[model samples]
Every structure is written in structure tokens, then in C-alpha cells.
Target: MKLIGSTSSPYVRKVRIVMAEKKLDYRFEAEDVWSEQTQIASSNPLGKVPCLIMEGSEAMFDSRVIVEYLDTLSPVGKLIPQGGRDRAAVKTWEALADGLLDASILARLEATWPSRQANERSQAWIDRQMEKIDLALVAMDKGLGDKPFCSGIHFSLSDIAVGCALGYLDFRFPALDWRARHPALEKLATKLALRQSFTDTLPS
Candidate 1:
């Protein structure tokens, strides 16, 4: 398998962390979707990164889809639960984390994308996205109150997704000071950082 994505993407990092935890081997093909020379569209019509090309040349897009499929491939370190409320809970945590990333990316593009004219850049839109991120953090903190992991005692996909989201904030929006606001998340991030999977896939 070949994973096509930029090192900077939190979504891509999530998938990479899962693969590493599962002890899976695959080629990493870095692609800058923002560059004019990028051929991302050939694999993902949406032009997104984290597209996985499988053994038979079949392509899979969307980090969530790729990670879910990967969890089924090996039993070394199961991330997602098998069924019922447990599976739904893990997925809900993933959705929250992914939503945070989506807002962060949107706000980042609004504030920094050079293609947009100064007048075209909307500070209001950026602020709105930031609001979503802030709310999500509070929710995460409340949901994770005193737990060893996002999904209770076990290190699961919930932790992977949340860890990647926090890491992305540190990489791109350090001024947000999320660690100070939410110590639980900070603790989680610190613990995750020590894992080889998280360390190896740190956002560049």
C-alpha cells in the first residue's frame, strides 16, 4: 500500500499513527495538494490528501475511511470497537476530533492562504471556525474527565484522533494556548507523544 499525503496534514497523521500501532508496512508518498503540480485528483476526486492505494491498485480516500478499513486488517492493536454502543462512542469521539481539524484548517486557510485578496479574507469567518474549535475542546475535556484515555481505560482510536488534533493545533496555531486551557488534553497529548507511533508521525 502507498499512502499519499503531506506530512503537515493532521488527517494524514491520524492514519499514519494507526498503521504504525498496527505494525503495518506501507510506502509513504508525500504530496502537496496545494501545489500546482499535485496529482491528487487522479486518486481522490475531492483533491484531498491521505489517499491510500491498495495492493491491487484500488484507491481509498478520506482518512476516516482508510483508518476504519485498516483497523479490520490486523488484530495486533485494535483501535475501533467491534459493535454496539462502544463502537458508536469511539466513532463519536473521532467525529469530534475530525470536526476540530476541519474547523482549524478552514480558519488557517482564511487567515494565511496567499491566493485570497486582503479584502476577501474574512476575519469573521476565521473567528467562527475558532469558536467551533474552542467549543470542541471544552466538550472533549468534559467527556474525558479523569480518564486514562479518551475511551476510558484503553488507548483506542479516540485517543489517536484527539492526539492528532491537538498536535495539529500545536504545529499551526501555537498561540491558541490550548494546553493551558485544557490540562486533561495536554496530559493526553504528552502521553501520546511518548508513543512511537505518535512520535514517528509528528506533523512537520
Candidate 2:
């Protein structure tokens, strides 16, 4: 098995973290999807990163699908709950975290396009996304509450997804200062950073 993605992508990082936690061995191929030479389109029509390729099976796309499939392959460090309401809760957490990342990336991309920034309407759209991120941060802080991890007690996919989202914010939007606004999230990030999986896969 092998994974193809860039280190800077939060989506890719989430998949990598799950792979590490599960102790799954696979070749990490760094592919720049933006590059003309990238084979991303072959595996994923959307030309996205974090495509997982198995020896004989079809390649898997999307971090959520890939991670969920990988979780089933090993019971060792099960990041996802087996089933029931528990599984749904973890999936909900993942949706929120991933949605936060999606919004953040859109805003950042819009900011990079100076012409878009100059347009009042486009700028307003960007602002809306930023506001979404702010609200998501507050919700994440409150959702976490006093739990050690997102789901409480054992560390799960909720932690991995949220941790990667926070890490991406730090890497791309350092001025956001999420830590100052959410101290509980700060501690969660601190604890997650200590994990070998996180340390090994820290975005450059």
C-alpha cells in the first residue's frame, strides 16, 4: 500500500496520522497535485491529494473515506468507534473539523488572489468564511468542554481530525491566534503534539 500527497495538506496529514496510529506501513509519495506531472487525476477525478493506492485494489480518494477504510484494516489503535451513536458522534466531529478546514482553505485561497480581495463582494465572501472559522473555533472549544479528548476518555478520530485542522491553521494562518481564544483547544493541541504520529507528520 502507498499514500500520495503533499506534507502541507491538512487532509493528507489526517490520513497520515491515522496510518501512523494504526502502525500501517506504506510508502509515502509526495505528489504536488497542482503540478502538471501529477497523476492525481487518474486516481481521483477531482485531482485531490491524499490518494491511497493498494497493490491490487483501486485507489481510494478523500481523507474521510481513506481513513475510515484504513481504520477497519486494523484493530490496534482504532481511531473510529465500531458502530451505533458513538460512531455517529465521531463522524459528526470529523464533519465539523473537516468543514472548518474547507472554509479556511477557501478563505486563504481567496486572500491569495489579489483581484478577488479588491472586489467588495468577493472580499465579503472571504470574510464570511473567516467568520465561519471563528464560530467553529468557539463551538469546538465548547464541544470539547472538559473532556481530555474530543470523544472523552480514549483518543479517537475526533481528536485526529480536529488536531490536524488546528495544526493547519497554525501553519497557514499563524496570525489567527486560536490558542488565545480557546485555551482548552490549546491544551488539546499540546497533548496531541506529543504523540509520535503527530510529531513525525508535522507539516513543513
How close is every model to the real structure, measured as TM-score?
0.98, 0.95
Q: TM-score of the candidate numbered 1?
A: 0.98
How well is each residue in 1-204 modelled by candidate 2, as lDDT tens digits? 989999999999999999999999999999998777888888888899999999895799999999999999988999898899999999999999999999999998887855544554478878999999999999999999899999989999999999999999999999999999999999999999999999999998
Give all candidates' CA lDDT scores: 0.95, 0.93
Candidate 1 residue spans exceeding 4 A from truth = none
> Highest TM-score among the candidates is held by which one?
1
Question: Each prediction's Cα RMSD?
Answer: 0.7, 1.6
Which ten-residue region of model 2 has the weakest summed lDDT? 113-122
For model 1, residues 42-63, the per-residue Cα lDDT tens digits are 9999999999999988999999
Error at 60, model 2, angstroms? 0.6
Clashing pairs in 2: none
Write down the lDDT that model 1 would get.
0.95
